[model samples]
Target: MRLFIAEKPSLGRAIAEVLPKPLKKGEGFVTAANGDTVSWCIGHLLELQAPEAYNPAFKKWSHEHLPIIPEKWLLTPKRNTSKQLGVLRSLVKQASSLVHAGDPDREGQLLVDELINFLGVKGDKKAAVQRCLINDLNPAAVSQAVANLRRNQDFIPLSTSALARSRADWLYGINLTRAYTLQGQQVGYKGVLSVGRVQTPVLGLVVRRDLAIAAFVSHPFYEVWAQLATATGERFKAKWQPSAACQPYLDEQGRNLSRALADNVARRISGQTGTVSRLQREHKKQSAALPYSLSTLQIDASKAFGLSAQQTLDICQELYEKYQLITYPRSDCRFLPTEHHSQAATVVAAIEHNLGQLNGQAIATLPLNLQQKSRAWNDTKVSAHHAIIPTLKRHSGLSKAQGQVYGLVSRNYLIQFMAPYEFASTEVEVSIAAGSFIAKAIEPKVEGWKQLFPKRSAKAGDPAEDADQLLPNLTKGQLLSSLQADLLEKATSAPKPYSDATLLAAMTGIGAHVSDPAVRKILKDTDGLGTEATRAGIIELLFKRGFLLRQGKSIVATDTGRIFITALPDVATTPDMTAQWEAQLTAIAEGRGQYQALMDPLTEQLQAMTLASRSVVPTQLKGLGTAKVFGKKKRARKKTSA
Candidate 1:
């Protein structure tokens, strides 16, 4: 009998549904008519054994056991899912052939592969195992995936990369946490001084940002605007562009620091005749945004719906697993496989059905050219899983949050089949009394896909675009009258505190924060901080550990958090190490680097850090009030009728 072991029950059921008819359901598996069996793991049936499992003496958290690097890694069944592991073990022994069905990512690859190894499916049996990568749970998608199963051995490198990352996190976190917790205990702090590869750097981001904001000194900057009018009496305002001679009076950011310089320029330009020095018009087209990667979705959800990262992830998971409305919730890639382009019409139709009449009407009315291929449809950009997009399956009665997330996914997918937003951009530069001023205007040519999202605010570019009015058509050297000069004073504002949206964005695009160009490129190439599946959990972990707190819409570092970051070394609190590690992990995943190459130096680094941690005093931890405990709030019971 051929046994199919899926990553989870929902996926197992998805696989079983596509098999032969007359399915017989058992306690933990389903059997098809052709004597094929399908069983599944509950997420991860096993996890890496803890340090104490290696040796009893290591159970006590002490400096003496500082760098407890496991010479031989071991796995133990997670207690909650131990019974399922047992069932799989029995099934594995009875099966003549095995199929490994896991999510097509590093962690998912390791999840089922570990189970196969732990259950003693060895030698030829393990070598003969096949891998089925299922990203979408729809019957059609699952059937397609099952028909394309490849040898499981091909993914050993991917599994090895995940294993290295897991063990590295364990070695780094366990050793540092123990060493630091001991250091904190020396200073009479009662809380656990947790340190993690990803969490600490994340906390460091917030703490550093908070510190920068606190230290910022606000100063006034002056600007000179020329209010000019054409011969036809159409008027527009243009900002004064400081000449090279004005450098002495300007700040480093090119802001006019001297009010005298600003006032002089304003007075000189007012009511003066100025020649239109330059006029340029260009046609521009903005394509629809690519589909949602989990990070981008979380970022948008945080901004639009006030949902936290974890909340967005949970909602997407439901949309993927429960409703079967989205392809996958944990994708890093934002581009779809080109082959998926053929399903555009069906997916759009499904989206319309799920949207219902009231909302569906708008989607139906969209000029969706089903054949228009956007930059988002590229086979090469597609990774282990394609972008999170609407499936061909439809559903209704979703919760408000789920509906919002589904709408976002569906709308993004729909836009891919629509035309680009076309517009005319005109820029004017005028010279008045030796000072130059400029104005720009954007006029819509075609709403195109932008019509789907009415008046959505642009995230970047000029902040004053909304205030800009249309400029009159003029030729070069055309004379115009300067109506008036407006001298405005503005204060330089401090950096905004991290919000859910900005923080998630920071985690994903952490390369922008790095100073080293080479390292920055590496971080960008490797993605950042954590994978799409784990970033939300890492951020949530910081909050639970009292390293972060929410104030209004802003996320700030707690006193405990600030103190902890201050007490740690720069290497422990920065994203540089993460970039370096990711480079090695990616190499390992692609079979370019060996496990020992990454781990050897890592083990050596841990020893040095643990040794340094012994003499370190956690003085900053003192005087901080008790750490806030975060847990599920108990629901209030309805008052009993007397």
Candidate 2:
């Protein structure tokens, strides 16, 4: 029997239905009419053995066994997934050949590859092992992909990379987490200190933000604005442009810091008529946005539905797995495959059909241009999986949350088929008494791709391009009769706290925070701290560990979180280490790097860091749970006594 393994049961069933052959149903697998077997896994059947798995003594937490590095790694069947693992193991023994029909990403490769290793089946030969890679779950795509299968041996490097990442995480997380936790417990702290390769650095980011915001001191400043009306009773506003000589009242960024200077300028410009020194108009174009990646979709969903990162991913997973309305929801790739663009028409038709079924009035008025190929489609730019888009399969009875997430993916994909939004913008320089002020306006003539989104009216003098630009008919050298000026007082604020949306952005683009240039460049090429598929889970883990608290939409590091980060060394808490590891993992996946090259050094580092924890007295820790550990925290008096 030729066996095929899918990442999930729904996927296995979908492939079986596409072949048009009656499949024999079994306990945990299915058999096709041709006698070929198709089995499924509920994601990973096995997980890395925990610290205690290596030895019995390690089970108890103590500083004596600090930095416990596994001499030989092992895998244990997950409690709930043992039945499926057994079923697949039995089938693999009977089958002479195997086909890996798992998802295309590295995680999927690891899922099936590790299972193969555990089953003790030889899948080294071309005929003995094969791979099925397909992005869309539709019948046609699946059939075509299966028809041209490659040897599964070719994906060994991908699996190797995944293994390296998993072990490295275990090495760091298990040892270092124990180190800090034991140190904290010794000092009489009662809470568990949780840490990880990615989550620790991410927590550091929130703590840093809180520190910055807390340290910020407000300083008042002034900005001058002129309210003016044209000759035809049309009104507009501009600002007094500051020069380099305004240094005394300006900061490092050249932002004005003087109220008196702004007031003096306002006085000079009030009621002073100015001439339009220069007038320029140019047509601007806004190309269609690329389709949604997991992060981008998370951001949009968070903004549109007020959903957290984890909530968005859960809903999207439901849409992809349960409803089959969208392709592979775990994808981080934003670019669509050029060769696959031929299926664009089918996806559009499916979306239109689904919308028609549900009376989707949101996009009923917008027409989808099937032939318009935007920059989103590219042959080389596509990754393991393409953007999350509506598949060629239409699903009914989707939940409200699923429908909303589906709609976002659908509209983002649909917009790429439309023309660029075009607008003619006008900028005029007004010569006032104090200085030259500028007036700008944008008039959108072509609502091309903008038709998909609700039109936003721009406030007058607002710099945003889409805002309403109600401009009067004026030319160069035009005279303005009446003018009024006033100085507005404002203060510079510290960086805003990290919201779920901003926190994800930070994780994806954390190279901005790392000081080392080489590490920063590597982080730029390699995806940030965690893979797109796992970032949501990482955030959820932080919440479960009580390291992060949700304050409305913002993600605030808890008191325990701040302490944990401050307790760890910079080598562990900074993004530089994880980013460098991610880069090496990418190399390992491509067959250019060795696993031991990375792992050996990491083991030594974790052991060294653990040994260093001997001197750590948790109660004396400057940052971690200080108030609680010291018993010095107090509540403010209800009434003030002088």
Candidate 3:
């Protein structure tokens, strides 16, 4: 009998519908026409063994055992999932062939590989193990995936990557958690001082930002504005002393000078004719952004809909697992290769039909000039699944939030296949009284994919007015007159606290000040700090650990969190550590980097940190129950004398 194992129950059931089924059973298991038994795991049925499992004495927490490092890692069935493991174990024992149908990502590959290894299934001496690589859980994709099942050896690297990540996380989490907890207890603290590879760095970001905000000092600034009348007597506002340095003059605690200068600058330009000293015009095309990756979707949702990262992820997961209307929700890739474009129309049609108000007309109306050809959109770049796209399933029975998220995913998918937005820009530079001033306008020739979000406003910090403005016919060197002028006071603002949207962007290493193209590209490729699947969870873990608190949309670090980050070495707070680790892991995936190259350095660092911590004298404890200590001989003598 052939046994099929799926990543989750919903996907397993979906796969069963397309199989040549003989019978359907409860939960996620089914029997095929050839008597093949298929079942699914609820994510992972087994996990790494706990610290206590390494040694019986390790079960009890003690300060003596400062760091608990397991010599040999072990895997054990999860307590609540042992029954499911039992069923799978029995199936594995009896089966003549096995199909690994877990999710197509690294985690899925590792789960199946771990299960097989744990069950002692291997190497010409056991049932054949095949891997099913399905991008979508629908019938067609499932059928194709099964028909093209690859041998298990082909996926060894992916499995290795997954195992490496898990083990690294374990080594860091277990050792650091024990060390901190013991230290805290010795200091009379009761809570667990938790840390992890990703969470610690993420928390450090929040703490750093909080510190910056707390340390910021605001200053006053000023701007001079004038109401200018055109030759036709139409009124428009213009600013005096349009140099960037003008804003800083008023911010230097010279209110008297600032007011006097503002008045003088306004007077000097009141009757000046704004000249067009230079004329620059260009035509540019802006293509639609690539399709949604999990990270991108979360960012857009948080910015556009005011949803939190966790909220966006939850919505996407529901759409994928429950509604079955989208592809996998944890993918990092954003572009579909040329081969996947043919199926794009079908998915779009399905979404348009099911989503009321969006129809075939809307899909057809999208601009034709845009095409998906980004670096992110490669077939080989996709591992277990392609980018998140609408499934063949018609959208139905969705909650309001689901519909909103689905709309975002679906619209982005169709928009990518559309043409780029075309526009012509006009810049007029005028010289008057030996001073040069410039005026610019843009006229949109075609709306392109921007029509997808027609009602959407410009993003925050963008000019309130549209970039595309039709300027009246005017020649350079022709001048007009002015009517009024005024001065405006502005304050120098501190950096804004991180909202979920900006925080996600920051975690990905796309800082507001990072402008170097090569550096930006590296950050993008590396995903800044953590994978999309883990980033939100890392933030949530910080909150749960009292490292951060949500003040409205802003993430503020707690005092304890700040102190913890301050106490840690510089390497622990920076993304460079994660980036360096990721680089080695990627090399390992491609057979260019050795696992020891990464693990050895981490092990050394861990040992160094442990020793450093042990050498430090713990803080004195206060308010604890008082007790007296005596030499063992004196205590024994006193007891005998008594």
Model 2 lDDT tens row, 1-642: 888899899889877776647878889888888888889888888888877888899999887887788888899988878989989989888887888988888889988888888887652533368899877777777788779898888888898998898888877877777788778877766656756888888889999999999999988877777787887788877767787778777887666888788888888888778888988999999998899999999988887788888889889777777777888888889998887688888887778777652223445456667778898998688866898889888767777777778888888888898788999899888888748787788888888877777656545553422245477888898888546686777778899989888889899998999888999899999988798878887877777667889888888988878877777788778898888899899999999999998998987887788898777665754334433432442221111000
Q: Number of the top candidate by TM-score?
A: 1
* Per-residue lDDT of candidate 3, residues 1-642 (tens digit): 888888778877877777785675844367777687788887788777877888888777664664666778899887767888887888888888888887777778888888888988976734368888877777887787778888877777777877787888788777776776566567775466666777887777778788888899876555655554558875444434345555455334433237666666667777777765566788989877778888899989888788888889889888888877888888887866566666766776787676744423455445443344444357766666678888888856787778878988887777776667898887765554444344567678887777777554445542322344356666666566755556666666677888899889888764332455654455556667777677777776677667788889888887667777776666667665776667666666666767778777888788877666554333432222112211121211000000
| Worst-scoring 10-residue span by lDDT in model 2 | 633-642
TM-scores for every candidate against the unseen true structure:
0.95, 0.91, 0.86
Q: Across residues 1-642, which tens digit of lDDT does each residue of candidate 1 receive?
A: 999999888899999999999999998999999999999998877767888999999989888887998878988887778889889989999999999998889988988888888888888988999999888999999999999999999999999998888888888988998999888888877678889888888899999999999999999999888888888888888889999999998888999999998989888888899999999999999989999999999998898889999899888888888878998788998998888889888998998898852233467777789988989989888867899999999787998898888888888888888888899999999999988999888889998777667475565643433444788888999999997788888889999999999999998999988899998999988979888888888888787667899999999999889988998999999999989999999999999999988899999999899999988897877765354452443221111000
RMSD of each: 4.8, 6.6, 8.4
Q: Candidate 2, 196: how far from true, in Å?
A: 0.7
Using lDDT as the yardstick, the better of models 1 and 3 is: 1
Model 3: ten consecutive residues of lowest lDDT: 633-642
Instruction: Report model 2's TM-score to 2 decimal places.
Output: 0.91
Evaluate all candidate structures by whole-model CA lDDT and list the values in order: 0.86, 0.80, 0.70
Q: Supply candidate 2's per-residue lDDT for 323.
A: 70
Candidate 1 displacement at residue 335 in angstroms:
1.4
Error of 2 at 345 (Å): 3.4
lDDT of 3 at 444: 80
